[model samples]
Target: MAAVNRVFAAQLAGLPVFGPDGESIGKVRDLVAGLRLDQQAPRVLGLVVELATRRRVFVPMLRVTSIEPNAVTLATGSVNMRQFHRRPNEVLVLGQLADARAELGGVRVTVADAAMEPTRTRDWVLAKLAVRERSSRLGLGRRRSSLQVVPWTEVSGLSLGDLTEQPQGAGQLLMLFDTMRAVDIAATLRDLPVKRRHEVADAMDDERLADVIEEMPEDDQKDLLGYLAEERAADILEAMNPDDAADLLAELTPADQSRLLELMEPEESEPVRRLLAYSSDTAGGLMTPEPVVLSPDATVAEALARIRNPELPAALATMVFVCRPPQATPTGRYVGCVHFQRLLREPPADLVASAVDTDLPALRPGATLTEVTRYFAAYNLACGPVVDAGDHLIGAVTVDDVLDHLLPEGWRETGLHDVRSADPMKSEEWERA
Candidate 1:
């Protein structure tokens, strides 16, 4: 009944899901399969679609109208909104099966991909597996591993006993994460089992892991860091935003804080240590040491260029600080700041000092939470500069950080509901089937 009779599970990933009227719904994050106890091919259960609100839900295969190369059309827009939880007999194909060890024709191989096709009953089943030969035991005379596709029934070790509790690599999981935002990736990790979460984190590089860590809730952040070895944990801390790293470290015991700080490079640890010196509820504690700063003599074009960095957060790119001598924080005299809007109106070659906005007063490091909020409201500013007693720029606080502190504890976890509930289909719908 579908437009296509066969579809590769990997190709379905990241595809935009649409409703019958061509309305956009969500994107496919992974495929759910029901493993058979008799070693038969696993049945295709449904799709894990991440909605616009970042909530992931299940869409049964019977509701999927077509499996095209670029899109998956749903039979109807009215679907269950319950959060997806893997049942005892189910497994996430892309998340847990890819890179899993298996045997084909008595030869050991690794699952690289899988394919599903519709049977006469309109039920989809995992019919084929794309596998690669395992590398040689030793490095002496290793050759490139060859890849091939074989029937799922012929592949051993795909049953529930083989994959449900066994450790698997994250090769395919990382591929899906490559296209997601850091925040989305963090949310996805929160939904996975603790062991699986660590597997994915262990496979990630320091910089990428740091980005994901910064987006996670404080508790999850601390938990993941603790799971790593001391050296690797220190590297992750070094890669994180200094203020964020400090916040996470503050949660640990004082002994741990000192040990991690010692392991970090001196230059990298300096700002974090300085942040730790301040009270967590103060402006100095909430501000980030890495802000866009420029010397007074720099041109408007240069100021704009600095903020143009794709990696810079939207709030941090709102303006550029103009100081006297040292361009970095704790610089010379804190002259003033140039708003991003002002840079566009000024001549390219004109010095940034000419366009500086000096009317707004700077925030002191000791400014309380109430004082910071009042300052933001009074000035209608999205970001404010932090200065020491001598008027030296120390850091910049963005509105996002302020909101993070303002929100109640465990706010992130509160929004997520992970319960196993009954099917939404009515008795009438079931009777028709």
Candidate 2:
């Protein structure tokens, strides 16, 4: 008799599958599991296999005669070649569970991968998970150095419901949504039920939620903010970049906008309020109020240190604005900006003013979208400072914000921004029209 076999979901994926007569089949694309309310662990239904023809088919677990490290053997050489369709009660393990977050013994952990085992009844069940833990010593440089295999009963906060239907439980989904970008998480949340979406949002900290909210579509942004408590919503808005916060608030009713603004801290709400005063299509409306600003007298080394801040957005960090006194808004007459490249090429002791690009034209707050786009294209600029009539720098427009406005409506739903190629938890949802 064949030895009892068990393997992790991650290991099982991509393993070559064969027939009882030794004919080659295809590879395992995903594993389907049936959620059980009474049992913490779900039963493994079967496999979604991809054939040589690039067609996906469902092969029941009963047909799986032997499970080995290198391959899975079936009971017979034949398999039903019908297109795989997820049943109403089934969830895709690799598509949805891998990388999901779980809470074990009051400690939050990530499900880096999962495992399955056979019972006495000859049925395979999702039995354990490989949870990752990072040492705190690394701080921002933290890496998954250890993985613990725990029974499914020790985990919580994952939605095990049918992927095509309403999700069941919620605490965290997919390793704090690890190996996935914020925009991708927002896109996935857009497809979830309102309650499920809210659950996922609630599980995240203010900063992470703010990042996800900023990437969501306008309608989804409003819906999610509306679902949150007033104080909670205000906090999230405060956490987001002023430009993104203002854009989201602009979509709400005047009264709703006023309420959230009132609840926000004065310093955080001030810039957003100013941004809201501008027309949506104007340079002022699209610019982020926060950018790295330094005195022209500062050394290149100081400027480089400021840009190294982990919280600074990539686009905004590409250049440092040189300003005079009144360091806040109306940043004393906009002297000029020094590109990061210049800082790298110059001596650390050199004053930033020496490297300032005064020739680059500053954008007027009232400049139209077309004019701004032309300005960027003409100057080959990735970001441009916004100034008032008196040449006081108020904010900056990054290339990303400009592209967000210029892209077609419902661009997030399109696969143009899909990060699946880098995401290990693969799903075919983006392939749909």
Candidate 3:
């Protein structure tokens, strides 16, 4: 194997770990480094190897025989199977240090990566940082951030300063798992310590955070929201689905709920406020105020284009509701709905109104959970519309939401491990050192 004498922390992630005899172990999920009191580089502690069981364990640096481009070879095949827990002085290199802010030559920069090298005594230690300069504050027409590598001691803010004041790093972490599902991200967040979790969450954009929060359990969602600044929390809520946002808000104290709602824009908070007015078990509370609603004049091509949005949930994209006018939720005259398959069969130039399916009954705002469940089952529907007494299309209830309510509490957390541990090569993968 080609040896890796000097490697960036981010580069080590996902590389498979192997024993001295070339038996496969686990993969490198992260590197643990023990911070020092002075300017010296932090001592490299170990590799956080995640096994096929989805359990992570620490493999000490001393046990690593060689670091190759494709794998980390260990000194022995025997390993400590105990779960890895971060010590007080140790920090996850890629997880907590990447994307950190610092000063390089009197200019502010963000850490893109960190490099580690072994000393004469044969101990690995962080030695250099790859940093990208922040954009010009003078509105200089979108200059790209420039990257540079410097000795770790030259940059300020490299040390984990006051945890409360320090900006958390998550760029590399997000990049490594960019393709992960929101549910998978939520599961990963659950594994982090509270402080670390908040740091990671704080680094995510409002829309991304909203998606991940929607998949988390109610208690986890509440706790994470509480940890964020009230303004940021409100912004994230605005980005979430109206029903999920309302559900999360309903769990908070009335005063907290009122304050957050007040922070949100009037237009954004209106649907959420309306949903909160209903009992949590009712259709009004379960349905998302934002459904695929198009005007009767909308052509099949337009309807097809709307549902094709990558961000739209599969359940919500299954059908589009046709209304008279004012296509937004609480739309005019609940005319009828058209299934996606029907739109596919019709000509693109044809009016969507001609293909509407008005025979399926719409549920009322006060429909009980059981009634909603039966409605979906009876019609074999993935999505059903919720209409008001005046026959105004108000919202949509999807099968996924129904499943969330019907499943036992803590179901997300219960199935998280199993979802992550479903590898067919469980026996073939073994850890070393």
Candidate 4:
């Protein structure tokens, strides 16, 4: 994962969006977002994209690679060109997701596998991974192992510092990440406005910042989301725990839901769509998307091999259905599946069928919401799989999906009472309470 770059909804409001080759793709126009309230962090759902033709487009956050003051970047240069060449609303949302699946989204933040360890040796040795035939000839003893050093090659992208690098007495950061760099300070404005701080924080290249901000109360999230476009807000929500994703989407309009889902892949969107389709209180409706699938006759080595493919996405990976054959209709009956994570704990050659939880509870088509709720409460089950009369896996219902439906009107609330002004800090007073 790379670091996430950020900017306030206000600053990014009119930033020009650019292609990788620095072509002017368009500019940021307005931010589409949910409502918010008192001193809250924000959530972004999407962006109102404006092409050079003066046509406005709705770009979901996932498609937004980065947000800088002068320019925005996308994961791909060719985003729905067919639609872009057409008029507004003619562009489909799914095309953006297809682009994202191809790794089109630009860097939201810059990231590195970093550690916060203190070090002693100022002088250092380096590895030349980028150079061919450079097999790390520089050798150091174990005593030098603790020397603080970062592999320069590991840096994938570098944010162009504000066209100036003058060493100042007090440093005025373009943004503040948890990371500290050895640089001369220009000037530190101790009294920068909170809104400014929020905007500056948007430039941070930290994925964890969003998480920590989101972990605050809904009121804060609403405020923060107010500073982001709806598409970006939706991107963060989609990346969140499924439970949070459902909760956030519930507060959005049907049109927004449709738009956001269109930007998400079928693998990620389909299950949440299923979860959203339920009454938040039923088992057929409350099952987690994650499931255990298996090849009915798979050998231990085969089973182990599947687990090693981390590149395989989560929803697909979680399914361990032990069908008689792999990836097709089975000749034999559907056998049991062992949870992939737990498979390693047992004897290496243990068959999946023999290792499965035989007494697993499942849901039928017509199970009542109350009955299913009781099953979860009494059994502490995350969810149960739903099967037809033939016992073939049809779908699942997770507990969070149930809450999305069962929770009172409060669950969908974005907690933003609009302030008097357009900006989040100055919303309508009626929106405040």
C-alpha TM-scores of all predictions: 0.90, 0.67, 0.72, 0.39
Q: Over the stretch 1-433, how does candidate 2's per-residue lDDT look in tens digits?
A: 1566577777776689888878898787678887776647888878877665445667777778888889988884344554566665676776667545567888867667778888888778889888875334667855646889989888876655433343333433545366556875675565454655777787788998999998887889998899999999999999998999999999999999999999999999999999999998999999988888999899999999999998888888998999998778868988999999999999999999999999888999999999999998998888889999998899999988888889888665543432222332223332211
Residue 140 of model 3, lDDT score = 50
The residue ranges of model 1 lying beyond 4 angstroms of the native Cα positions read: 137-143, 411-433
Q: After superposition, how far is residue 310 of candidate 1 from its true place, in Å?
A: 2.0
For all candidates, what are the clash counts? 0, 5, 1, 67
Better of 2 and 3 by lDDT: 3
- Tens-place lDDT per residue, model 4, 346-415, is 6667666666665656676467877777766875555455654676665555565555556554322221
| Ranked candidates (TM-score, high to low) | 1, 3, 2, 4
Candidates, ranked, lDDT? 1, 3, 2, 4
Alpha-carbon deviation at 230 in model 1, angstroms: 0.5
lDDT (CA) for every model shown? 0.85, 0.78, 0.83, 0.43
Candidate 3 Cα outliers beyond 4 Å, as residue runs:
12-29, 33-89, 99-111, 116-204, 411-433
Question: What's the distance in Å from true for residue 113, model 3?
Answer: 2.4
Clashes of 3: 1
Please tell me which model should have the higher TM-score, number 2 or number 3: 3
User: What RMSD does each model have against the real structure?
Assistant: 3.3, 9.5, 5.9, 20.6
Over 1-433, each residue of candidate 3 has an lDDT whose tens digit, in order, gives 2345689987788788888888887788888888877878888877888765556777778779888777888885345565566766777777777777778779888888889898887778899888988755757577767678889888876666633256656776788668666875776677566777887887798999999999898889999999999999999999998999999999999999999999999999999999999988888889999999999999999999999999899999999999978888889999999999999999999999899999999999999999999999999999999999999999999999899999878777554243332333232133221
lDDT of 1 by residue, 121-151 (tens): 8888999899998755758677767779888
Q: Evaluated with TM-score, which candidate comes out highest?
A: 1
Question: lDDT (0-100) at residue 111 of candidate 3?
Answer: 84
